[model samples]
Target: MTRIPTLFFATAALFALIGMAWGIQMSASQDHALSPAHGHLNLIGFVAMAVFGGYYALNPLAAASRLAMVHYALTLAAVIVLVPGIVMALRGTGEALAKGGSVLALLSMALFLVAVLRHARGLMR
Candidate 1:
């Protein structure tokens, strides 16, 4: 359980650094335009992953069962779709992968929220 948090924090920090580097490069390149990659890295990689990890750490039981696979799957799904979607979106490709990726990301968040809430309620009793 703690490992989940540790991994999450580490992953988030890595993405944050990458995002900052991308930002610095953009700034130095005379292009103030926003790259979807920046948002994806920050939101999906750093923020979302950290939240999922926190939830898992706080509720170890959630990670002990098959549902753990679901959690990991959803997060991976988000990353899979999100990363490519960001690159495509930034390139002005109006495909539906980005939209679909967003939906998957939302689904992942919902899964995490439900799991955390259920765990919290279990603790209260």
Candidate 2:
């Protein structure tokens, strides 16, 4: 129950709530782009963060890596960037923030996976 997934879930939920509010208030708009934003936020932020955090928690060796700190930091940064990036896109900003956030998140996840694999290999030796 570290703060990462918790915060991610909460933030994603908030976005979902906002989207729902928009739907309820603006039924005549005919386009619900916010739902897609909410979907991405929940999928990437909540689900992925939970899975990553759970993996690290269950694998003590993985948690002990030097990359663990980097992983967590990058994850937090990605969430920070991602939420705003999603919202900004909903508000009609360019796609740069979303692209940057997605890249950071993907790279961070890849690094964490490498660390996990290395730790698992070490355990086999």
Candidate 3:
């Protein structure tokens, strides 16, 4: 119920909508070239974020922590950077944005790991 979890869930839903739209467009056009981007949007953006939100919802203490905010911000940044980066790469430009976004996404996941390790025990009871 905390803000972090709410944000994650909302973002996840948004990503799901986008991914679905992308998939529909690809299907309609019969051009599956952007399949990778679409996959990432669904898997990382929707699924991963939904899981993160679920975890934070179950562990309110972690959700309430400052680290949760950092994780949320980094995750959001990763999605923002990654989506455009992938688009650019698909357009034959470069992978800089994708790489940077990947790093940020990994850092966000690492932070999530830290939060789990630090607070998961409290939930065990």
Strongest candidate by TM-score = 3
- After superposing candidate 1 on the true structure, give the runs of residues whose Cα lies further than 4 Å from its correct spot: none
Models ranked on TM-score = 3, 1, 2
- State each model's CA lDDT, in order: 0.74, 0.68, 0.90
TM-score of each: 0.80, 0.69, 0.95
123: Cα error in model 3, Å: 2.5
Per-residue lDDT of model 1, residues 18-53, tens digit only: 888988998899675567767787888888887777
Candidate 3 per-residue C-alpha lDDT over 7-120 given as tens digits, one digit per residue, 9 for 90 to 100: 999999999999999999999999998888788788889998999999999989999999999888888898888878888889899999989988988998999899999997
Give me the runs in candidate 3 sitting further than 4 Å from their true place: none
Any residue pairs clashing in model 2, and if so which? none
Clash number for candidate 1:
0
Q: How accurate is candidate 1 locally (lDDT)?
A: 0.74
User: Which residue segments of model 2 deviate by more than 4 Å?
Assistant: 1-31, 123-125
